[model samples]
Target: MTITVFTNARLLDLQGGTLTAPSAVLVEGDRISGIGATDGFPEGAKVIDLAGKTLMPGLIDCHFHVVAYSLDLWANAIAPDSLAGLRAAKVMSGLLDAGFTTIRDLGGADLGLVRGVEEGLIDGPDLVICGKGLSMTGGHTDLRQRTDVRPRCPWLAPRQHGRSG
Candidate 1:
């Protein structure tokens, strides 16, 4: 297996709240085979100089809505499914690039996006999708204005709106 070494870096050890001095990390293939002050591991191993930078694990967002492309709920709710999926792909890639390695989607995401991420069709956060959220007219997910007519959205089904009676 191929090996790579990262040197001249400070390693963060959260177990004891410590920072190592100029440590080295040895990576074999896609996984880190060794860590902390490593040297002379193997011949022809690629070396990366961190220049005293800190290396840490990626972050995770516990809650997100990948399918909601617009702040205006009506805009997103009315968009075609294909269009919404495309927009989600872009947003998910940005989330991955921003170091969100894991995310839990609260609503408006399905297995299709999960499959895309797994197959590498799009670079994105590891999704823990909760499927579609239950919404009602005049509820949090409903975005209709006061002047809007009945049937806030066909997708959400306005008949499901809550009633005070």
Candidate 2:
């Protein structure tokens, strides 16, 4: 297998809390093969001089919301599949550019959005989405009422046909 080597890097060792000078790294395909100094570099390997730039692993964002609105949370709660997917793609690019290589979507996402990113149908973060949130009737995310007014419990509505407390 062919190997690529990166040399002259300033390594940020997060676990050891040390900034190493003149560090080296080896990449066999997409995965990192080893890391240390160039003195041990294998023969006939491609080499890259990092020129003393810091080298670290990609960043991660544990909590993210791909579909969100500043003024209308209720509207986003009921957003259509197409629009939600589009929003997810846009947000994913922003997060990736900001150095977040992975994310865990806490809410407001369905499997289709995640699948779209995975299948390359959209450009977005690596997503782990909770299909939907759980909320009681008239609770924080209830969207049964008109956007201009507070939501009423379906059971409490005069036209309701279900039991109520």
Candidate 3:
């Protein structure tokens, strides 16, 4: 197993509501095996001194719209599918940089994005997606305006009747 030892770091204990003094964290492969002083760590283990920086657990976002790239519904609806996916990728990277390790997306994120994370194609958090957004005929997820009479988006396939417009 690949071992990494992180030393000289202040560990944050959320449950106990305390910040520990300089400590050592031992990681084996992808999992954290232990947290304490560096003694007894295996030889040849890679070591990184944190220089008195704080190390805390990654955060979680329970409510995130991965495809809602913009606040304006119309703008998001009009954006191309590829463009929206690209924008979501950027959002994911930003969230990861901010220490978010997991995100639950309520809408618009597809299986592709989820797979992207699992396969390490995307540098982002673990994603829990709903496949697609659901909405009532005229509920919050409905992007239609009262005065508008066009289909929701152009990239979408034709309706059941094969009507393109």
> For every model shown, what is its TM-score relative to the native structure?
0.76, 0.71, 0.81
Q: What's the CA error at residue 16 for candidate 1, in Å?
A: 6.7
Candidate 3, superposed: residue stretches over 4 Å from native: 146-165
Q: Among all windows of ten consecutive residues in candidate 2, which has the lowest summed lDDT?
A: 144-153
lDDT of 1 by residue, 31-121 (tens): 9888876567579998999999987778999989999897887788889999999999999999988889999999899999999999999
- In terms of lDDT, model 2 sits at 0.77
Clashing pairs in 3: none
Better of 1 and 2 by TM-score: 1
RMSD in order of candidates: 6.0, 4.8, 6.4
The lowest-lDDT stretch of 10 consecutive residues in candidate 3 is 154-163
lDDT of 2 by residue, 1-165 (tens): 888998997888779998887888998988998888677788888998988888777787776677874348777767887876677678788887777777887777778877887898877667787767678867766666646575655877877468876
Number of backbone clashes in candidate 3? 0
Give the whole-model CA lDDT for all candidates, comma-separated.
0.87, 0.77, 0.87
Tell me which residue pairs clash in candidate 1: none
Residue-by-residue lDDT tens digits, candidate 3, 9-107: 899888998888899999999999999985777898999999899987899999999788888867887899889888999999999999999999988
Assess candidate 3 and give its lDDT: 0.87
lDDT for 102 (candidate 3): 95
